[model samples]
Target: MVYDEHESTARFLLPATGVTIDILPGSEIEVEVIYREIFEDGVYCKHGRNVADRMKDEAGAGGSKQVMNVKALLNVALGDRVCAAGVPFTLFPRHPGNSTLNPEERIRVQRGIVEPYFFEGARQYVVPMTTLSDVMEERGIERVDILKVDVEGAELMVLKGVQDVHWSRISQVVMEVPDIDEEIYTEGTIASVKRVLLITQLLKKHGFMVITEFDPNGKNHMVYARRI
Candidate 1:
């Protein structure tokens, strides 16, 4: 069996070596192999960025942390108006829920699966999954404290949109980085380990400190970070 240099797919040069290795082209094998390779090498491994370095960069940013999740934002507000760095701001819930059913149910019915609830709160703004940076820029908010993103598998796109944002005020971030294999391949979503690693590196360069991570029971991983 041979894996490609890009690591996108593994080909079985010679049939089973009696090892019966499940050759899941874009599945668990991909995640394990990529992760192991990165672990063995340093930051600039075959992948790219390591978790530790990314966290450090996030911490060093000077921006006002913007909590992307509506529930989290509400919790921070605590009955008081939303304010970051003395700058009064409005809370924007990207995908708000409807009154007919729970948010989780709404998402599940929309996706045709019993998935977890990601967004909650009043309908403030219905932004596309890939236009986070555009929303922020349009709002004219200079400093974003923490962007608590939990968009099922659209994290990569969201991160991509904000690639040019000033990292100083966008200090901290907490996102759910789903299992590349399960979420993307198995579930037929547009997620990949390569994309995740790319976004991780971008965050690292900006000064965020990736602190905690929760692996999916059998599906995804949640990465939490803070600005130093």
Candidate 2:
């Protein structure tokens, strides 16, 4: 599930994933073309491409009327491990680690690049996962307006690599957390229930405020925040 926030204060949730722009009264929208980049993670099934295409369509329709240049970092996985162990196994932008892998099992999992099932199910395989900081450093990006994180259960680990200085450059963030009753069990690991609280606390500590927490979607919780 996806939710997008625009300028207009349309008080209803549409329950869909598409690009929409709302030029609200008394609200100002600005578009700058100096190195416009859209870094998309979890590019499984080219979901990010679909989103970018939608954004382009919206932009052509008299929205973001500035001569904007768009760049993207789509489909590059963002996590600690390419895959982890659990009921069926898990995949990430990095290797989940071999702390849980047995001698024989590890050998087989390490043979070749782990591939994800084309469908919506988690079929175990080891692959390569990358990090946001690494990519940003490579591109010499000093600031990130929006950082959207949707790693299955390794969100915290990813955030760990972001230095405090980088926090100052980041203006907003959108992340997924597990629901209170729901537990994220993957790669022979179980994420803590305080995951959301931890994320909220950390972001707040870094000068960001948790402005919006979407209604729990039975499976996970979505939190949107901005620097204060």
Candidate 3:
């Protein structure tokens, strides 16, 4: 299930064994069985276990259990939060890491090129994710109305460093969660969907509502959020 907190309520998306439901009003609604099977083709066995076998095993050994596809489940929960908030937001691009480019180019650009381009737009300042916290501190930024974070595979790390900061002041966040692709960064590895869930949980805990998610063909998956 996905839940996002908005100004006064929450949005929800729930996916059951063979169905998916989108809830925008934070209230229950009756849905027919037909709507539940809209994307039956995408369903599959988990961990090599066929559906029947899994069900039989569960039935035999049942107490109360919650088995889920982490990625899909997280998406649903995030969707819920977004529906409640009723906010509009956009996703940001992925941040290219130093390992993605040649050492000389990375150094030259880090020290020489980025500054000019970062300041070219009004209310926009681009900097490496690793240095974001430092930049915020140096700039005396006590509040961030909107934040766009895309730090390649280092998104989790960047978020980790600022977990305890005053994130309530942040009205929006658009972050890219890296996927498996060495072409982008030598250090890149397959980021678990569970890790993404943790990040979303953190944001939700701080009163931010995920508003939307974008899965573009040639780019990293993005999660967009706004403050409750």
The candidate scoring highest on lDDT is 2
Candidate 3 local accuracy as lDDT?
0.42
Candidate 1, residues 1-228: lDDT per residue as tens digits? 112222353333322233334333434433343345345533122122434545456655735553232332221211112223332212213222111212332353345222333233323222212245555565676866556655544556556556454556675676655545313455555654444565567677777666434444424445555565
Q: Local distance difference test, per candidate?
A: 0.43, 0.49, 0.42
What is the Cα-based lDDT of residue 17 in candidate 2? 36
* Number of residue pairs clashing in candidate 2, backbone atoms closer than 3 angstroms, sequence gap of 3 or more or interchain: 12
TM-score rank order: 2, 1, 3
After TM-score superposition, the amount by which residue 215's alpha carbon in candidate 2 deviates from its true location, in angstroms, is 2.7
Please say which candidate is ahead in lDDT: 2 or 3: 2
Cα TM-score per model: 0.39, 0.48, 0.37
Which candidate comes out best when scored by TM-score? Answer: 2
Where does model 3 exceed 4 Å of error?
1-131, 180-193, 212-216
How many clashing pairs per prediction, in order? 27, 12, 17
Between 1 and 2, whose TM-score is larger? Answer: 2
- Once superposed on the true structure, which residue ranges of model 1 sit more than 4 Å away at CA? 1-130, 181-195
